[model samples]
Each structure stands twice: as C-alpha cells, then as structure tokens.
Target: MPIVKNLVTQMSGQIQVESQLGKGTTFTVELPFQSAEQEEHPCGGTLDNPVSLEGKHILLAEDNAVNMEIATEFLTMNGMKVTQAWDGQEAVECFATSLPYTFDAILMDMQMPKLDGCTAARQIRALSRSDAATVPIIAVTANAFAEDMAATTAAGMDAHISKPIDFAALCCTLGRLIGKSSKN
Candidate 1:
C-alpha cells in the first residue's frame, strides 16, 4: 500500500477513498501516462522495433493470480512459452523436474508462500544439472532496495526487475540474458 501510494504521488496522481461505516473502504488511484503514440519518451525503445522475446521458454513464478495472468498474457503475446508456478516451492520443483537446459530463463517473484524466491534460487543453483549454474534466474519483485538486490545476487539470481514491472526493460533483459546463455 505504501509503495502504491508513493508511485501514485510520484506520478502526480491522486488517490481517492470512499468509506462506509459498516461496509468496507474503496480506494481509487489515478496515474497519468503517455499515450501509445507518444514516442522518444521514458522507458526507452520504439514500438515498431521492440525487443524480440520469441521462441524462448521461460519459467514464471508468481503467487498472485492476477499478476500471473497479466504476465503470462504479455509473455505469450511476445512469442515466449511460459510455465507458471504458483509459488516459490513450486518453482523450485518445476525446475528440478524439468529436463536440463529446457528453460532459457526464470522470472522468480521474491515473496511467496512456502519457500521464498531467494531460497528457491539457491536450491536451483545447487542442483547438479548442467544448466543449474548457467541458466539465468531473474528476481522479479517489489523489493527494490539495495539490500534486496544484494540478497538475490547472493542467492544466485542473475538479475533483478522490481515490480510493477517495466515491460520494455523486462523484454530487453530477457533478450540479453537468454542470448548470452545460448552462446555459452
């Protein structure tokens, strides 16, 4: 909630609240954004030559259903095959059971039920498979603190993408990481 409020305020937006005493409270946040036609703006790159995320197999680990659905939709739309894992434990197990080198990369949410992403990443790195240390494991989370990033690195994550995710950055990062992995 703090993060949401901060983001809204930073974007010169307003948050409205409606409270009914015996009922519940509703909050509405409105943020300003450039239209699709707006070019040469922040977040980088043009829409016409957008980063290609095609033909890569990605393992996505997110506990939130709505977040998972949104991520899956965008990833699939960009031609990447996604394997969903509802939690960090499931993510670890999914990777463990997968054939080595099957996943080009992993998008792992930091906070989750059962095991957290850091632990899951560590476990994945500890595996004996040939790709265990080679595959890119990207930490996707709301924890953008410096310490949080350090923790992910300590746990064997190759990169970090703070939420709410920047789609352009995500795509470029995936492309760069996967491309690098394929070379090795």
Candidate 2:
C-alpha cells in the first residue's frame, strides 16, 4: 500500500513490483544499509535518557475497561497517577472540574458515547481556565491512519497515540509532552 511505499521512499529506499497473469504479484523493498551505531543512534549521536513520568498525574480517558486497567497499571508501575474517564463527555467534565495544572496530560480515546474525542478535546481547550490551552491532550485510539492523526490535530488535541498502546513509546511520548527531565 501507499503507506509502506511512502515509508520505504522516506528511508531513501526503492521498491519494485512484478506480476503475471493468474499469479500472485510480488513486491520488493530495498533501503540503504545502516551500521549498528546508526541504528542505535538514530539521530547520529549519543541519545539522552528517556524522560521519566514518576509522580506526574495523568487523566486517562478510555471507554474500554480492559484498556483502562492496562494503561492505568502501566502508568502506576511507572509512578504516574491516573484518573480514569469512561467517555469523552466525562473526560471534558473531569478536566473542567479539576484544579488548574492538576494533570500533566490527558490520554483521550477518539471514539466514545455521549461525545466523541474531537468534541471533548475542543471543549477542554475552550475552557476558561489557565491550563485549558496549555494542557496536553493526547488522542489514544485505534484509528491509526494518517488522516485520523490529522483529525486529532484539527480537533485541538496536542498529540495522537494509536492503540493497542506501545507502553515504552507511551512513556516516552508522555515524557516528551509533559515530563520534567530527570537531569533537571
């Protein structure tokens, strides 16, 4: 598909396709070789330690019980406090009622009953509180398409994280978005 092709091209790679009547098509992708150092140090130098989320408070807005529990447990294991919201409307309400700067970030599900993620995000952003505009609202959903990402941005979300969540990536993203560096 276009996504795979685009990824290959972005890596300064090439792709070829071959097909024959009554036979399955074949596709090949080739990219410039990378050394171990290049692979490890993607930025071409030593990488800083990933920021830690210890003691940070997070608002987790997810509808599914299993997902909420998993995400909550992971966050707690990483020393972050989690406040759960079952749907988008509840998420908006929770943010509205909370004290300013009480949350380090919000993980919002894109689909929910009562109100969708986009509407809730806009509502949160429209709040009159000081933290309304500043708080990071991250869309956490199954919609991983490029257009879906764009939709989250358009809806005033600060970030987008697709599910099933990548716990390490989630931590790093949260750290980047709202954490204070351990070096601080």
Candidate 3:
C-alpha cells in the first residue's frame, strides 16, 4: 500500500505525495502566503482546518536566535501570537511583569542563559499570587530523556516537548489543557 503526505505551503496551497512499493516520487511547490477562504471545523483533533490565533498569546523562551525564529514562525503560522525571550531570566521577567494569567501558555527552553527553564518554572510555581501560580508551563527542549522529563515534572512543568517541536503533539497538549481543538 502507498502512503500520502500533505505538505502545506505558506499559502493555503498544499503539495500532495503518493509513495508505493519499490517506487519513489518527488514534488515541489512554490507559493506565496495568501489569505484564503476560511474553513470551519470541529476543534480538538489534529490541526487540519484553519483556526483563529487572534486572542491566543504564547510566551516563547529560548536562548538561541535561530531556535527563536523557528519556534516563532511555527507558532505564528498556526494563528498564535508569540512573545520571545532570549533566555530564562528574561522569561521569568516576562512572566513576573505581565498581567497575571494573561498568557495562554509558556514554552520554556531547557538550556538558557541565567535562570534556565527549571529554575524559571520553579519561580513561577512559587508565586504567592494565585493567578500566576497555576499557569501552564510546558518544557520545550532538545533534551529527550527519562531523567529530563522527570526533572521538568518535578520543577512544576505541566508537559514536556522534545525540540524540533512536533506540531501535532504540541496541539494535542494545548488541547488537553486549554480545552480547545487545534483543528479549529
């Protein structure tokens, strides 16, 4: 049996692929990011339909510029508004100063200058203010190990995501927490 993979372009265009036994295929698509007719669908599943990222605000804490760009691009592509912090210290500041409970989620990078993800998460958890205390802090890092997950959990992170972030998994996690479907 053959498998089909759909590569969505910057615009609403998509490249479709079909692969079969003992055979190979290739395709390229060049398209601009253009506004298209909105399609509505039931939420909570995979991101298969266009969704409104209008009011959603995500705080992204990463030390690397390249990583920040990549993450910002991905999150923004899916209709998310993002605030980027160059390191964990800045992340902490952002969380501490911003209106409590204003952010939808915090994507914390494990390896960051100054405060680091675990420390930042702990500080956020330790907040005396109740609104800021329970905000979902999700670990986003390249470190994928049992110990790493355990450590993050101990630090009060609600979930952990291995870097080169998986869109589907992120969507699923957000859905479970925020009660919204990515396929909106």
Candidate 4:
C-alpha cells in the first residue's frame, strides 16, 4: 500500500483509499493531464536512444516485490545484470560474502523490514575488501528530502535516487558513477 501510494505521488498523482468493514477497499487515483500545448514539455523527454549498461552487475535491495520486479526488468532491458536482495540484512550479507569487485554497483532502498539501506551501506563500506570503500552504492528510495540525501551520504552511499524511479536519471547516474560510455 505504501509503495503504491509513494509511486503514484512521485509521479505527481493523488491516490485515495476507501474501505468498509467486511468489504474490499477501493483506491482512487487522480493524475494530472497535459493539454496539447503542454504536451511538448512532458515531464521526462522520450528516449530516442536508450542507454546501455552492458557488462554491469547491480545489487538491488528492495522490499516490495512489485518495485523489485519493475526495477529488475528495466535494468535488464538496458543490458545490465541485476541481483536481488529482499532486505537490508540480505544486501549486507550478499555484499560481504561476494568476491571483491563482484558487483559494479548497488541500488539500495531506504526502508526495509530488517536493518535498513543506511545500515547496509555502512556495513558494506566497513567490509574488509578491496572494493568495499570504492564500490558505488546508490540509494533508490522514497525519501526525497535534503536530510535524506545527507543521511545516505553519511552512510557512505555515492548517490541518491528518489522514487518513483526515473529511468533516464537512473541511467545517467549509473553511467557517471561507474564511468560507463554513453550509448547515444
């Protein structure tokens, strides 16, 4: 429920939920419409050429199954390999156990059931591995405030991405962080 609401709001839409005892709930979503004149300035421009993340391996830590699937599909479409971690603890464990430099980057979520993105990042940074201090850990979260970014930075994350995820921005961030060549 929270994930759905967050994604909707992030896309500049409103969602309302109504429920009654012994009855199913109904969710109403209101999204802004752009007029023909305004259509020229669509939020994010359409991709004439999509960025390729070939040969990149990403560790994605997300609690929501739907969100995880969406992200994984997007990344995969861009030619990147994605590894899933359901929570912060699993992320930490995955990073700790993997070989040094195994993953090119990590996409972390701030809120999770066990541990948290911040704690996981700290733990990964603290690991005794060659890439522990250098691997780019990017926060993919719903926390979009200045303090949230500061917190992610303090936890050793290299970048912060707010949800709902913007594919173009995500591609650019990943490219900049990992020094990938532009596809177009």
lDDT of 2 by residue, 1-184 (tens): 6645755775679999999989989999899976654443332233344455789999998888877887898899989999999999999999999988899889999889999999999999999988888788889988999999999999988778777776656766777778432222
Candidate 3 lDDT: 0.75
- What TM-score do all the candidates reach, one by one? 0.77, 0.71, 0.70, 0.73
lDDT of 1 by residue, 46-144 (tens): 666665678889999999987898789889998999999999999999999999999999999999999999999999999999999989999999899
Worst 10 residues of 1 by lDDT: 39-48
Q: Write the per-residue lDDT of candidate 3 for residues 1-94, one digit (tens) a residue.
A: 0111222432345565566768887565555443443432334432365334546788999998877887788789888889998888898888
* Residue pairs with clashing backbones, model 4: none
- State the lDDT of candidate 4 residue by residue for 52-149, as single tens digits: 46889999999999999999998998799999999999999998989888898999999998989999999999998788888889999979999999
Candidate 3 segments whose C-alpha is farther than 4 A from its true place: 1-54, 180-184
User: Better model by lDDT, 2 or 4?
Assistant: 4
Worst 10 residues of 2 by lDDT: 40-49
Question: Which candidate tops lDDT?
Answer: 1
Better of 1 and 2 by lDDT: 1
Ranked candidates, highest TM-score first: 1, 4, 2, 3
lDDT of 4 at 184: 13
Descending-lDDT candidate ranking: 1, 4, 2, 3
